[model samples]
Target: MTADARPSLAALSAPLVARLIDDAPALRLGIERVGGARVVDAGIRHPGGLEAGRRIAELCMGGLGRATLGAVPGTAAWPFGVTVHSAQPVLACLASQYAGWSLSHGDFFALGSGPGRALARQEALFDELGYTNAADNAAFVLEVDKPPPAELVAHIASTCAIAPDNLTLVLTPTQSLAGTVQVVARVLEVALHKVHALGFPLDRVVDGIGMAPLPPPGGGFLTAMGRTNDAILYGGTVQLHVTGPDVEAEELANRLPSSASRDHGRPFAEVFAAVKGDFYAIDSMLFSPARVTVTALDSGHSFHAGTLAPELVERSFTHVP
Candidate 1:
């Protein structure tokens, strides 16, 4: 859930984190079906891609009360499949829970064929990874740079055509299909660690951060987040409260009247001016858990924690994220 609300940094161990990157196919890791035929024609030359799709389906089914992984007696799926609820944490734990798929990294690419348009889109997807076409799969995995929705849909479409009446899409409130949530958390944890080591104040660190949870085209909860910590990356004047950019303060101020317009260094400056002192107390309702009171913490900001993942619109990365 929220690495932020975590009481101590001790929860993160180097070895535990390292275990997430294994090149194995995680079968029966609790997938819920969003709704689809038993035989989906996911078009992918890469086994990894296909497996990813299958995992999504399993998770979706689990959410719909249609199926599950374990062999529990009297389970809805019966002898073939059990039943699971669509939950983000369940999806996130898929890989870790499965250790016997025995699928190899290279074998992953051989599962399905890529259509012409899909191959073309792969170019852009690969580009998003900041890699040239020459980059191997092994090299590409070094970073988690997923393609945007348009490209991703085209890629999936080219790989496997969903059958008629199979258009259902289920999701876990805890996560998304885009695999964004899990990856983003890892990134944040790293940044969090670095900032903590440097003795950066928690509020200051969280202030500049922005988050966006991307929906999964597949059935699993693959939430993603996009952030703008550029201010910290470069030697900017304002130590951004978080990685998120605050140049939109005026706009945000206008949009959220109840909250102070604390974009980047601007709001802090205002607080400093009002207080006429070195330390200023700055609080804001700039972020909201839209479902409940404001935007979700997963949409951006760690106020809600991971367990409380709240859905956010695309614009969340700007203000609410």
Candidate 2:
């Protein structure tokens, strides 16, 4: 399909953003205005919880996907889990939810995600996908402990060619309940990202489903970030449906899981600290789900790889003191 034929991601996600604002009180989200731009505080000063995270996860996908929280058997203390699926997996996961845009001002830095990115097209990924969009309004999700500065907000609006009043930003801290859920909710996005990095044809990706055990929010930022990343690296699972030859599907499955990286086995925080927090020093292949299944649609066969490291998951989630 041609890029021009695609739906406007900003337009698709507008209603979800509006609904989040309208239901801010019930969701325990703080609705505030920053320099004429609307800010939805999912964790900062408010006690945003699971439901809010679920909704925010969908918003992160630009309304092109569904995120549901549930409990599966055999999870022990961490029984709760998050499942996400998208029919437009490529566009929803990579185009909108990938957290690929970098935004910074002074001491504050954030990677911007959600439908608003489709409008800005700031990253080269957009060009590779041959996708561009326009909208009167834009919505973004920033994994931040506080709202962005006015200058950064203004720059975002100008870049998207939208008014500040038409802009909405959602703030989520990694140590908060809402923040943990939303970040762990990126299980499917993590898979798609790995697939892209593997040089698989994005157009062949038809559908995807991903689930990960949700850990309790950690006591500090480092612990929280570790839990989130470990949730995917050790406890996450993904199944992708694609149109391709069986051999290609098998190859993709073999190469797609977190275990494919030499940096696997250890908790992500340890890995980060080992590299002195230089994310670039770590293996790029380490950012995938624990287990993966890729189904070749035309041939009706599925290939699987990797294993769930519940031992590591338990150690990571419970040992933080």
| Top TM-score prediction, candidate number | 2
Q: Which residue pairs collide, candidate 2?
A: none
The C-alpha TM-scores of every prediction are: 0.21, 0.98
lDDT of 1 by residue, 1-321 (tens): 343332211122112212212322242122222122112212221123323333433332122111123332221211211122222221111111111112123212211111111112233322322212110011011112221133333333333343322221112122232222222222222223333333433333333222222222222212122221111111111112232333332222223221222432222223344555434253333222111111222334322211111212212222321
Give per-residue lDDT, candidate 1, residue 84. Answer: 24
Predicted candidate 2 versus true structure: per-residue lDDT over 212-314, tens digit per residue: 9999999999999999999999999999999989999999999999999999999988999999999899999999999999999999999999999888999
The TM-score obtained by model 2 is 0.98
| Model 1, C-alpha of 91: deviation from truth (Å) | 24
State model 1's lDDT.
0.23
Q: Report the error of model 2 at residue 175, Å.
A: 0.8
Candidate 2 residues lying further than 4 Å off, grouped into runs, are none
